[model samples]
Target: MTAQNEVTFRLTRCRRSVPRTRALAHAVLGEWGMSQDVLEVAELVLSELVTNALRVPVPSDRQVGVRIARPLEDGLLRLEVSDAGAGRPEVRAPGDEETGGRGLLLVEALAHRWGVEERAGGIGKTVWVELKAPDIVPEPVGREIAAAMVRPGYRLRARGEWRVVVSVRSEQCDAGYSAVVLGLDEGPALRVQAVEPLVVRQCEDVMSAAIQLEIAP
Candidate 1:
C-alpha cells in the first residue's frame, strides 16, 4: 500500500487564509468520510496550527504551507503547517486574564502527538500534529471510474451544499487524481483530490452518494 493519502496547500500570510485553509481541510476530510467526531477535532487542530503559523515573524512575501494526510496503514490524520520564520513553538499554560498564547495549549490537548521540525531543505520550520481517526473505512473504487468521476465538470454535495469540480490533476507517483472544487454559493474554494488508492476510492464513494441524492425523488 502507498504510505499515505495527502494534500498540500500554499496560502498567502493573511488573517483570512486561516478560515480558508480550515474550510479546505474540512471539505477534503469530509470527502474521505472521516467521522463527525474526528472532523470536529481535526478542524480545531488545523485552525490553531495555521493561526500560529501566521503569527510567526516571516517576510511578507513568504507563503504558509499546509499539508493534511492520513497514513494508509494506521488510523491517524496528520496536519503540518510550515513557515519561513525560525523559532520553535512552545506550549505554555495561559493565565486566566490572558487573551492570547493558548493556541499550542489547545493543540497539545486535542492532538495525540505534535512537534516542530526543520522544514526539509527549506528556510523555516514545520509544526505538525497527529490525531486519531476512528471508524473511517476508505471506500473502494476502480481507477478508471475514479478518474472519470473527478473531472472538471463533476459535481458533488458535501456538508449539505453542492460543489462543482473546478480542476483535476493526475498524481505523478501513483494512479490517483486530485481535484479542486468550489461550493455553489461560496466562491473560489480549494483542492479536493485524493492521492492514495484508498482515498481515490473514498472520493468515488462521495460521488456515488451525490449521484444517489441527485436522482432521488
Candidate 2:
C-alpha cells in the first residue's frame, strides 16, 4: 500500500507507558502488513519519543502525546512524539562517561529520515521519524490470535502482573513477529483470539482464517 494507505494514532505521554506505546505501533503495523526492518525503525523512533517525553517537563495543564502517521508521497511510516516541554531537542554527540543522550543518536542512525517540530498547541515539540515499509501484507491466515502472543509453541510465565502467550504456526504467513511481548501493568487487557478464515472481507463476510478478539480478565 502507498503512504496514503497508512494509518495514524495518538497517545498520552508517560515514561512507564512506553510499553503501551510500543503495543500501539505493533497492532497498527500488523494491520498494515509492514516489515521487520520497518518495525525496527518504528520502535527506535518510539523509544526516542518516549524517553524525551519522560525526561522533559510539562506545563501544569498539559500532557505528552504521540502521533504515528504515513505521508502520502511514498509508503513512508512516520512516528511523532510530542510533549509540553519548553525547549527543542538538540542533537548531541554521546560522551564516553554519559549513560544518557544516546537515544536520539539511535533514532538518527536507524530511521530513513527524522526530525522534530513544534506542536500546534504551541506548548511543546514533537520528534518524528519516517522510514520505508515492507511491501508484503500478512494474509492474516494461518495465524492464531491468543490472549497473549508468544512465539508459537512457546509458553510465557511471569511472577509479576503480566500473563499471556502467542505462537507462530507459520513464519511465512506471520513474518516479523514482535519479540517484545508486553504484559499488562494493571486493569483488564484485550486479546485477539484465533478465528476461522484467516482473512475476512468485513464484519459480515467471514474468512476461513480469521482471528477473533475477546476481553480478558
Candidate 3:
C-alpha cells in the first residue's frame, strides 16, 4: 500500500443516524470542490453499507465507523464503512421491475472500483469504494488521460485482477498545490515521461471550448 491522506469517522449502529454519515461525507468532499454528482454517489454507497450493518447483529456495544481517505498522489477518493457483524455480505441479483436490492448495484456503478475486507484487528468487515477525481490543473496531457482511465492513484490490485488506486490532497509549500498520485497493484507500474506542455494546454482549451459550446445557443 502507498502512503497518502486518510480520515476516519465512527457511526453508531442505528438506521436513523445514516443521514449524519452522509452529512459528514458532504462536508469532506465540499472542501475539495468535488462535483455534486460525485458526492451523491458517495452518500448512496455509505447508505447501502451502513444499512446492511444495521440489519445484522453486532457483538456487545460495538458501533460502526466510516473512513474517508484520498491518497495524496492518486487522485482517488476512498470510503470504508466497518461494523462488527459476523457474516460476509452477498450481492443479490435483482429481477425486472424491482424497486430495492440496488444499493450495492449503485456502488458498483458509481465507484471507479470497490470491495469488502475483514477489519485488521478482529471480526467484522469494511466495505470500500474509490472514485477518481480530475487531476490538479496543469497536469501533463498524457498523464491526465491515463489518470482518468487508470483510476488516479490506485497502488494495489487484487490477487488476480489488475486494479489501480489514486490519492489526492491539498498541500502548501511556497504556495498551495493539489497532488495526484497513481498506483498499480499486482503488476509492474509505469514511470512518468515528459510531453510538449503546449499540447497539454491545447487539449484543455479544446475541452473548455466544448463545454462553452454546449451551453451556447
**Highest-scoring model, TM-score:** 1
Model 2: per-residue Cα lDDT over 160-193, one tens digit each: 2123333333211243332233233333432333
Q: Rank the candidates by TM-score, best first.
A: 1, 3, 2
Q: Return the top candidate by lDDT.
A: 1
Tens digits of per-residue lDDT, candidate 1, 37-148, equal: 9998988888888888898887899999999887765788889999999979999888999999999999999989999999987689999999988665543323334332
Candidate 2 global Cα RMSD: 14.3
Candidates sorted by lDDT, descending order? 1, 3, 2
Predict model 1's lDDT versus the native: 0.70
Over 4 Å off, model 3: 1-4, 97-99, 135-217
Per-residue alpha-carbon lDDT of model 3 for 1-217, expressed as tens digits?
Answer: 2222455778776667688888877777766556777777777887787877777776647888888776656778788888877777767779988977877777787889888899998788888888876531111222233222233333322332334443322222232332223334435543322111111122233443322101111
Position 56, candidate 2: lDDT: 82
Our model 1 lands, by Cα RMSD against the true structure, at 12.4
| TM-scores for every candidate against the unseen true structure | 0.63, 0.56, 0.57
Report clashes for each candidate as comma-separated counts.
Answer: 2, 16, 21
Candidate 1, residue 22: lDDT:
75
